[model samples]
Target: MNTPHTIVETTLVPHTAFEEATQRLEQCFSYADGASEPICIALVGESRTGKSRALEECFTRHAPIRQPDGLTTPILRVKTPSKPTVKSLAELMLRALADPRAYSGTENAKTSRLLKLMNESGVKMVMIDEFQHFYDKGSHKVMHHVADWLKVLVDDARVALVVAGLPTCRAVIDQNEQLAGRFLSPVFMPRFDWQDTDQREEFIAILGAFQESMGEAFDLPAFTGDEMAFRFYCATGGLIGYLTKFLRQAVWNAIDAKTTTIDLANLLRAHSEAIWAKDGPTGLPSPFDRRFSTAATDDLLARIKRIGIPAEEIRLPRSKAARQTGALGVQAVLTAR
Candidate 1:
């Protein structure tokens, strides 16, 4: 029997966007095998759009194997370190390859070792997550050397490369012409938009799937009914991550209360504690509140759209005076030296 806790924690409902992304990743893996030139792809999305999950799903499909001589990793996945430099990025790849001297080698040494290991381990595809780290948020500059190094590494290794990150990470590729040319059409995982008819129906169906899962464990209300589904969409801003979080919290609440069923009250409690606590105040009424209006007003929709989207990139001032001032600072330091 599926317990509420287990069902909520372990279930991964595959939605349309997630399925499409995973399929593309699998295609990339197959195309890279024995290909004359390396295949490269970029997976870009906002946080919680299931980018990492899709990468993970594809990685599981190409699980590493152990032979008498050593381990053979078909796919190597590494997270890009924050504010990555070539040295740091190389070290990370080395560590993923299980190099004992991952931290000790010089950048060039590490790169050589990394390539050798990839060949020995039979690495066909490399998956890099958090690729936005290649673009420094503070300085608004792409780490060109790191991007260049990665491009060369994939080319030399003759392996497919899949880099997944926030939408801002696109700057890393856009700024590097060589890197840009090597990539396929980028795969995008976007949040579910309630305004779109197809997306709205898909979101409702996703809710129905969750409700069915929960129903197996406990008595569940008609969570997929029109009003309830709309409420859930409002609460989660149509992001599957937020919906899962909200549902998990509600399940936990039910278990804590020694209840065998979930109701709107449980959802209301979950909304107040789980969604608002992490996302901050949205000035909107609780979607689960019985008295709350379910009408989809334009004003309401506009505010909901901002729920899970990341803040806009910081725009650094670009002016002749600013450049001159920066140059003067560098010149003053150089003169002091």
Candidate 2:
């Protein structure tokens, strides 16, 4: 019998796109003080595409500085509210700074306090995650007022801003001409493409890393195997986040069933219970089935593409959204710098 020495912690593999985006963000942060105008960058992608994970990694590298009098934060990261307004955004920052009176103020008063606190704290760069909330995707309405407020804040504060969220968030900035001009071209985090030769190679390399990390969790099917890799590509639709999840669940199933090695049955069980249950039953063919064909692959890919649309416009199974939020906790755990 074999068992893992340790559970798989949320592993952050610095893929190429993630590294490039981080470099761009670092440049923006470093350039803020000397530049005449404020620098802004956006990390846009679909959910589970590792945008938030990349930002979290960058944030940890530039952690707040502790001084004798008070803390001086060189980089401040805050989560945007689902319904973001000047007041709610202010409260988020205040709370992140550990201000005692985070919630007690009018919108104007809150904005004033936020700016004063930011300046006094010596914050040079601000990172806002889940920025898709800036617009009402369901209503197809842009929150132009909030966008205006953010533009003014950035100008007055003279700090660089890094915003990351689903691609829909791009509309929020695009709707405001000043913001559109200020935000440099967005860095997109894309999912794995099965059809691309290079992507397939890189993805297998990623899987190899996972195999190593699993230690003795039970021999996972070799990702290099043509059939095995195809099954994995089908199961996860090229989202590294989903790939980790499916593998994790399969390991757990093996453990509970006292199985010596993971097999096709274990994977199918995990897929239905862990991935499909939440992702909704779309009548997609199971990769484990003997009859599974390229037609099934095409259908699955189409569904994955639909998920990249604006968050509100896309309808998800209730459990799916909840599960996504839960999975984020694993991603939030930062790896070593």
Candidate 3:
């Protein structure tokens, strides 16, 4: 029997952008072998746009195989360490390859060991996530030396490289001429936009898929209708991560409350508990609130629109922001009209 938790956690609602990104990754993995030059790809997107998930799905298809000699790791995946240096990165890669002395080696020694292990483990493609870490957050500078090292490493190992991270990470490749020249066209995973007709429809379809999944366990309020879908968009800003977080919370809430159906009241409570912490409140009205008006909703959507791609520039509207002044200010701005 599948619990609501299992249903929500396991269900991956396919949308257009996500599907396209997956296809691109598959193509990269498939053609990695028998290529003269090292194949490279960049998967860049804002946080919570499913960049990591897409990589994981592709990784699953090429699972590691165990043979008489040793385990064959076809694809090596590692997250970039915060404030990554060449030494730290080499060590991290060694650790992923199960090196006993991953932290004990000198930089050159680690690099040598990494290459040997890559050959030994049969690693053909290297996938690095959280690649934005290559950019210094405080100084706003790209780690050029490290990027250069990676370029050389890929070239020497003769393995395909895929780096996934925030859109800002594009600078990591763009700034390095050698690296940029080696990469195929970048793959972008962006949040759904309400203003775009196709995106809006896809967002609704995603909600419908989630609703169907949850419906298997408990009756969920209609989430596919335009008006209701718009409300959900306001709540999650059309980011699949936020939407899944919100729905996961609703599922748990339903279980705890001993309810068979997730109603608007349940969603209101879930929004409060899941979307934002009680400590910090955004002044904005809860999209799930019965009293939340169209004007307020539009006001919220407008604010979300301002959060353009490369979401780092303007942080997503948080509950804390809502608790402070924006919520009341939005109401004040709306009420005056």
Candidate 4:
């Protein structure tokens, strides 16, 4: 089975949005070191649009610097708890700092330890992914207490705060004017635009890059072919994360079935089984059927290849509502008195 090999070959594909986000993060990282006040920046996007990945890439670039004094983490990254409470948030930070006794204290105690560790560890920046957890959507409440706590902690520490989360995170940040004012303009990582001439070429180039990276290993199908590329884009709704996911599964399926090549059929089956199997019908046309091909698809592809079109007039596919990444429970946020 090509399982082991295929798993190793799966890698991050750098497209336009990812690259741009990385550049902005680099600037943020540099600005954190000497800023007079704590710097805040929000990385906002739909789930699976690479917000977390971009933050992670920046974190990796500026890893902990070990010295005789101690290990100095330049960028401390952690994910918010699934159920966000003041206690849980403190515990998350403590755990990320490698404190064994992360869960051993009251909320106030944990908060003290969190701040102490951040200073002692020489943490210059903090990155919290899935930050939207701080807001409870079902109850329509913002965790004002937690937000105030964070604002105080960051100000005291004087470290940059890099928060990445879903679009809903904007609401959480907006509720606190003091917290919201600290943040620089948010960097939005949008999905690929199929109708935009430059974006389409860049998207296709990303597909070509993936094929070049993995094609020879498995005798993969022509992913960059005009029709195949359009189909892949449609299947993935132009999200690189989904595109990579679909391709990875298709590769594994090809290997397990002892097939020599990945074809449209393999991809179609992979789509139905993996991507949207549980979501039910999306009311969108299937990209797999030959009869599903239309003049609209052709014209879109034509515009993409030619890179000639009125930028304002070109009609692109509308984005579907953002999918929930996990099941949210019946919970309420603690508002500040």
Scanning candidate 3 in windows of ten residues, the lowest lDDT window is 305-314
- 1-337 per-residue lDDT for model 1 (tens digits): 5666878756777888899889888998998978878888888887878899889889988898989999999999999987788888888888888989999878888899999999999999999999999898788899988888899999999999999999989999999999998888999988888789999988898888888888887788897788888898888877777888888998888899998888888899888888655353256568898877889888887777777766677778789998999999999999999
Best by lDDT: 1
In order of appearance, the predictions have TM-scores of 0.89, 0.82, 0.87, 0.82
Candidate 3 displacement at residue 333 in angstroms: 53
**Superposed Cα deviation of residue 140, candidate 4 (Å):** 1.5
Per-residue lDDT value at 217 in model 2: 57
Clashes of each: 0, 0, 11, 0
Candidate 3 lDDT, tens digit per residue, 1-337? 5677777778987777788888988888888888898999988888778899999988889878999998899999999999999999998888888889999878888999999999999998999999999998778799999999999998889999999999889988988999999999988888888988999999999989888889998987799987789788877777888788878899888888888799998888887787544212257677788876645355566676543233245566678856778779989989999
Cα lDDT tens digits for candidate 4, 1-337 = 3343464235667877888888888887788877988889999987667888899789989898888988788888889877678888888899888888998999889989988999899888889999888888767788888889889989988899989988889998998999999998999987667778787787788888877766666666777777777777666666666777777777777778876576667878777766754222244456766755634465554432322111244556544432222212212222321
CA lDDT scores, all candidates in order: 0.86, 0.78, 0.84, 0.76
When 3 and 4 are scored with TM-score, the better candidate is: 3
**Superior candidate under TM-score, 1 versus 4:** 1
Point out the higher-scoring one by TM-score: 2 or 4: 2
What is the per-residue lDDT of model 2 for residues 65-120, given as tens digits with 9 covering 90 to 100? Answer: 88998988888799988888888888989888778899999998888888898888
Query: What is residue 325's positional error in candidate 1, in angstroms?
Result: 19
Runs of candidate 1 with Cα error greater than 4 angstroms are 1-3, 276-281, 312-337
lDDT of 2: 0.78
Residue 219 of model 2 has an lDDT of: 70
RMSD of 3: 10.4
